[model samples]
Target: MNNNEHLTKRRGMTAEDLLRLRSVRDPHYAPDGTRVVFVEKSIDEENQYRSHLYMWTKDGAVRPWTFGPWRDTKPRFSPNGETIAFLSDRSGRTQLWLLPTDGGEARQLTFFKNGVRDYVWSPDGTFLIALTTLGDDETIEDREEPEKAEVKRADLKPRVVERLYYKSDAAGFLDGKRAVLARIDALSGKIEALTGREEEIGSFAISPNGRTLAFVANRNEDPDTTFTRDIILLDLEKKTEMNLTNGCGTFASLGWSPDGMKLAAIGHDLAYLGATIHRLYVFELERQTKRVLTADWDAHLGDAMVGDTHADAKSPGPIWASDGSGLYVTASERGRVNVYFVSLDGPIAPVVEGDFHLYGFTVHPNGRQAVAAISSPTSIGDLYAVSLADGTKTRLTRANEALENEVVFADAKPFTYQSTDGWEIQGWIMKPPELGEGEKAPLVVEIHGGPHAMYGFTFFHEWQLLASRGYAVLFTNPRGSHGYGQSFVNAVRGDYGGMDYEDIMAGVNAALNRFDFIDKERLGVTGGSYGGFMTNWIVGHTDRFKAAVTQRSISNWLSFSGVSDIGYFFTKWEIGCDVWEDAERLWHHSPLKYVQNIRTPLLILHSERDYRCPIEQAEQLFIALKRLGRETKLVRFPDANHDLSRTGSPALRLERLRHIVGWFDHYLKGPFG
Candidate 1:
């Protein structure tokens, strides 16, 4: 049936519909701008996500380029536009694969034992630069062992912890492996190590002339203690390297200018530490000088819109214009992520502005056009052809057209209200599309993870699912959220449960006052990470919420200061004190201290492998509530990390949604459910 006819039979969106949703991301334009390639990811019957490459031409025709059950992502056209290179795990490990534009079977390019992490093509397209990890004692020349005997599961050696940054949320425990750079011949597939396994490489970019390489890394004696990310310049011919930034500040998303005379990056010094806004910087190669392009721009430089539907979104850094006039970048401002143009002289202008999130994009070689992956409240990301001169965007791909036709999504209505100290807070409310007139509906206050991240116009599946289930979903970008100026984004620091808490409660009040259809008495609250901390704080401080769910949360600041992967430095940076420096203050900020006051039925959801907040936080809260004879339950997800809500297994994500919705139905809806 045609989409027009299918729309007439539209049904309410369901949690299970997540499996049918396809996420389009990382659009890269061919050198000539005649074609664009992007990755389309969807869940298969096995509940595993399969990402395949899809190609779109200037004629508006879109077709699948690679049919792979495994993930095939980061498609980049060669400089000559002859072949497209991407990373794939179809070969057991993620390796670089190349597919000819003229038509041929894709060929694997790298055979590293651990597989490639990231790669970029050379300016001349003769070679490629790739990043791979190596053990402390392992050399780049070491070959993979052949047919090694499998050790018994119980015989595995215990992991000895040594470094402060020993484990990460999604990456698990570190094995003393450092990310190193390697050069691979495009044709012969020969690989040679360019950097040793001493320090881990962060982000790297090849010079336009193919003569130099600029990479971000902290080479200090104790890199763990400092947040300094120095840009190092490597001379390909001389085999010499020099620190470009000279330990000035933390920087990332490095890009070389077209003339190869300047390097553009996004970062900031520890002016605000963890809450620092990311600014654009251009370094003159010859003059050895750095210029901050967005020094006057108040909003954060990169995309900070929080959503769960996208994966591997490209960093919208400074994409140098072909004529060397300026560069294009995405910035978060007022609950929207849009592309902007920053000139060499310092003037910054918007290139793409709308109520949609530009998650990823690639500029055309001609510099006049770009292919962007844009999503909105009603759309689940699609490719668009954007004109750089006039900010005109033309829709190129309707990836989720079928899903849109089959299901009805609630429209997110944006609103602003005054919070603590008369600070303006931005928020959105999504009411069920089928809400009867004058009928009150249960309100679910959804809090975003990153206190630094903003809840914007992006298509959020979980919000839509809640709205479809006859719940009014209210989400707000309180203080400490990006997109609202630097002062606002940094306001939550050192005041975790203070003003931030007031801002959220004020948002809930604002929603109740503005929306007559919302039933304030049957209110529910849920959030993860920093949001989870806020959830715990909210329930402990007030009995207003009827139900609450905290995911991968923080219950005790003192315990979190040592247990989390980023606990040590993050505690000092955000809380303004370490465990030893001010234990009493940490305890005061902890939600566990006020657990006795929590009367709301709380549901604790956490991932077993979540090293960011650590599952211990949930354990502490669950045990405390259970000991107090309070109504609480703990739901643990096995083999998942802190990113379980966004990037977890398809089946597990659905299960999580079920648990959340079911809990709210029982507590908030009660007999009506």
Candidate 2:
């Protein structure tokens, strides 16, 4: 065979191939700094995700640490490095499990009625502190019941909803359960409730001395009314607590100094509502004062970098240097998630910089070495050992080497251009590989959700599927997108369909002008969440695109204000108006108002259980377009939330890809003719 024939033997990536690939995440370094362990997830034959633990060493090889048909995750090494603890559901219910470092049988740990949500190892490694939903089983047993039979009692039941926040996208309907902190004795297996309050803990961290715990919570009577989070320090010995951040704007990701004399966290002033970029702050425990550490950064701290397909993405807080020099943190800047070393004196320097997304990472105790879960447009996630001295990264695990070498993926080129208002915008374009001369591929303009989120350097399976189907994909970080300073992210607020719309159209224009292989006439656009909202708005405002797919989208802001989980506050914060205060203004910005102008063939995709954008949003759009004699269709995914495109069921995710590709090909590629 010739050399050119061997080069052309690679096949395009398909949905099935994407699903079969394993994903690695949550790299945690052992105390001795010799070993690292992370979670590896793969789709089973039943299309269910199965997670197992894998360990990596500096001079040794990467191998599986735990194995089973059931899922095991969240591995953490003990302080002494003699054992490892992780969460497992092998016993029908998720519980904590421990394994010896020298190799031994795994032992089940916590046995909570309601499974544990999160956990932490105490500094002394004598106890395992965890956050679990306080159960009502004891309270239910004491209640009077007319029928003792389970079948009779289950025949008829009316669910009562009292709280304003009764349902969530992640955890279906609320069961009047509150999250509480508890401590489990490592040796005795006795569990004790640590906090008696009913407030939900946002996050927590253990102090170096093991005498204190720093946590964030919303202690207000009606936490839904205001965006407030307060930090509290609990003395393990005295059982007393002190408020550190006393009801400031939303605060989280607490990190304690090595000496236990100070605390660090990332939060905002609530000045810009949801679009506010988080700033790092250091709190002096002795003086009871707090100072801003990265006030001038103008970027959001802690992983805002987005990737569509990921098994597990755990955000790592600031890792303090052992010598008390500074702390290491990952933040989104431009298009990359870079690790930065923040000095105690407030200077910040990058320890690792690249055009890739670091979803999960951990620093060694000595702080000179670290392991990161890195992913790029062309590559799925894999583990890499990074050196703090010279910012050099060494590949640690080849999780998807076969998939990487066999799949012919397109290359994403970064681009910059001026929008309509003289503002600089950043974006990327992926041209289909092996396109012949004098042949132009169809262009697909993909928008990211979080109108506040940027689109770059992240692995997106859906984009790859589209590119493999001979489509030129264009994604951009328009105004109101993060990673371009706080002002740009906040720019979409109060002007959802205005400047943001212009910025998107400007991106489409740039791709058409810069690339001669892009067939502008055969254009397709798709997005989910805020991106979905923009897709709806784009189709209503222009007829340039031939096909459009809007997933979990927003149509009418008036109905969304009352139906969606965050609609009430998000509307007031992002739209700058309430439903009653300014109904006309809300209707004016809604894409439903301009549905008559939508000439493009539209496909509306929504999850039935999505609480964030409610299925009503898509139903309303589909009905309006169909009634107006416009081309439209709706596909509903059952039992899935707003994350259907990313972390939904394996079967449904592949179906979603098929539906999207079918719709776009029917219009843009013209099999209909």
Candidate 2 global Cα RMSD: 2.7
C-alpha local distance difference test of each model: 0.89, 0.85
TM-score, structure 2 vs. true: 0.96
Residue lDDT tens for model 2, 1-673: 9744654888787988757778899988888898998999888888887899998987769989888788898999999999899998887667789999899999988766666778899998999888777644532112112333455655777878877777778888877777778788888878777785666787888898888888888888897686789888888889999888777777988888888898988888888888999888889888988888888777788777666666247778887888877788888988888889989885799988899888888988877788888889988889888898998988888898998889887878999988999999998999887667789999999888887777789788888888889999999988888898988899899999999999989999988999999997899999989989999999999999999999999999999999988887988888889999999999998999999999999999999999999999999899988999998999999999998877889899899989999999899987741
- Candidate 1 vs. true structure, TM-score: 0.97
lDDT of 2: 0.85
Which 10 consecutive residues of model 1 have the lowest summed lDDT? Answer: 140-149
Clashing pairs in 2: none
What is the per-residue lDDT of model 1 for residues 496-523, given as tens digits with 9 covering 90 to 100?
Answer: 9999898999999899999999987799
The alpha-carbon deviation from the true structure for residue 338 of candidate 1, after best TM-score superposition, in angstroms, is 0.2
Superposed model 2: Cα runs more than 4 Å off: 1-7, 136-153
Please give the lDDT score at residue 146 for candidate 2. Answer: 39
Residue 253 of candidate 2: its Cα lDDT? Answer: 86
